[model samples]
Target: MTRTPQSARTTTRGIPRILAAGLIVVIAAIAAALGYQSQNASSSSAPSPPSPIAPRSERPGSLGAGGAVPDGVTVFDDGYPAVANLDPDLLRALRAAATDAADDGVKFYVNSGWRSPERQNQLLREAVSKYGSEEEAARWVATADTSPHVSGDAIDIGRSNATAWLSEHGAEYGLCQIYRNEPWHYELRTNAIDHDCPHMYADPTQDPRMRQ
Candidate 1:
């Protein structure tokens, strides 16, 4: 198309305003993205303990761990891998206990289990960012070196009944709660089957095992 001198001049003059409007839009989009992220972080603040367990009639299928991963179960959704990345013995014991719990109308579900060192560190950093300090974060997330999650030996059970049932009967299964503050965190303590579970640490800071 032929450009008239008058038309070319007008086009050139409008370029600055178009560039300015585009810059404004880009800045606004960035602001909106950041705001959405901040709101999501605030809303997803670490999950607090859930409510007490509600009793239900005994159900089958979830009964034995020897079978395939059950329906309605997925790694991120239910936190149970086809095989938990936990310590072999510990994972075996957990499955056995979960099978038993299923017979009693409780379904044992994993909330957190077997974290990679990188994942553990990321969680710690996030916790610190959320809690405002490392000390405060330590109360919840543990260091990668000391975290049983990183070692693939700890399991955090979900569902109140699973935890509650374990609270009362876990000794039989050799699953013991580790932290008083984290009732969901359980570890395989074969000795606990005969002896009572050890005195619980009030939090990570009190646990000598967590020494940095």
Candidate 2:
């Protein structure tokens, strides 16, 4: 029996179809490989977040070597009258500095410390009553937000001779006076000594409550 030419042509067409199928498979495999490689490259290129830092005081204890509070420092809780809120470390530093100052015959006392929001409001109201305006009162007594005393990180220290002494030596104890106009008010300033001294606050003006 003779095979028809048409049958031969159909067999040749089937060869091409098989070849096309193989080509499609090759293309799909290449595409899948490229997609996987792209995904891996993107993942490898992404940046990692930074690790968190531990507090300075938590390091191994070694007399100013680790983060522990300095020697000869005492922690005082003045019943919120001297400080509305005080970090334990800062309180220790203040007591240390004050004791050192006393040794030098420069005695100091904390006149004002922390104030609650309600207490601040009361102060503001009193200032308004005395000054006849909230704005004028703010110049003397800070508004709620601008008042560093509210955080318990600030204190108003007084002593006829110790003010200058404190100004000169407070940095050694991690304390610094804020607002040049308010010589009595000092706040913690060093993270190594006191972690409470963050540079930024919600309001930095003398009285943020008076802004609006």
Candidate 3:
């Protein structure tokens, strides 16, 4: 065999080094791609945060049923709706009476109870608007100052069953209907628990208290 040239031998040795450098670059590129893939996979699998919700008690302008009354606000108890701002004696008596009535399958509900002067006046104004005159409105709504509702001394029950029950059993609890036409209206008659309820007024017109 002829002796190889020195330059050719040198060039032949350089070829292995070039191939080794290329192999190293290829391995580094593969490792970098695998690292990126692993990071992306880990980030995509993490959990998202939960969304929030509000309860009914958080609503504005009105307190929820079954909740404690807020500060400076006179609202009803869990069992009584539309009954607020009442005399403590009256409310206590009414609740006691309602508890008894419930035992006999009569659940007493209040359709109307105490009202602020503004509320009473607004009602009277609306009534006058509906009836076309104060005289006609007096047949239904009373002046704010004279209205028992503004005084927290009156309550209005709904449902004929409850009213009928009150007609029969209310005297025992001192809740007596005070008007013939307004059979739903009742006032605490302390004497009723001992004797009998006072005779009902024929109407608001005839009630002597209305004149005052």
Candidate 4:
């Protein structure tokens, strides 16, 4: 027996449904693969953040609690024509020592205090011009680095007898006469860092704070 045209038409319509279902499954698989690849690429491309650095500690023997000047004392730059400046504590000690010496009939005066590096250089040049060489001038006045006056930690007292008394009793006021060769110069006996430069006669015109 022969097949009817209606039956053939029904077969064609069922084939189209099966093809559509298969196409939907293929599109879903492709979409899932693309989503997985995108997630993996994003994870691999991202960067991590860096860590922070630590701060450094302060240097030892620097001016502060254990500085050269003793506690409860402050330094002032007495506008002396010869000296550079004076530490507050050192000035207090000097005033105290001078007063004490005066009570014992020993008159005292502050001859010198701070010195600028430029003034020191001028003195050095003068010495070189008059004496002969830099070495010979250095013998009379200390080089910039060796100048205790530049540090505002030294003072030159006028009277020898008063200074002698200070040497004996100055420690009570936290003062000490540094450099045995120069009896006139006195410094604070505290724990401040010591500079190796010696004292020199500097010009009064330069800035006191700019000294070596």
Best by lDDT: 1
Candidate 1 lDDT, 79-179, residue by residue in tens: 34324556888877877787787799988766677776777788899999999999999999999899988787787777788899999999897889989
Superposed model 1: Cα runs more than 4 Å off: 1-83
TM-score of each: 0.62, 0.52, 0.67, 0.47
By TM-score, who's the top model here?
A: 3
Candidate 2 C-alpha error for residue 136, in Å? 2.2
Clashing pairs in 1: none
Residue 25's lDDT within candidate 1 is 100
Q: What TM-score should be assigned to candidate 1? A: 0.62
What is the Å distance of residue 98 in model 2 from its true position?
Answer: 0.6
Over 4 Å off, model 2:
1-84, 191-212
Regions more than 4 Å wrong, model 4 = 1-84, 129-131, 191-212
Worst 10 residues of 4 by lDDT: 65-74
Alpha-carbon lDDT of model 1: 0.77
Model 2 worst lDDT window (10 residues) = 62-71
Each model's C-alpha lDDT? 0.77, 0.64, 0.76, 0.61
Instruction: Name every residue pair that clashes in candidate 3.
Output: none
Tens-place lDDT per residue, model 2, 38-143, is: 9999999989878776565454332222111222222353433443246666677788888898788876665556666667777779988999996667666776
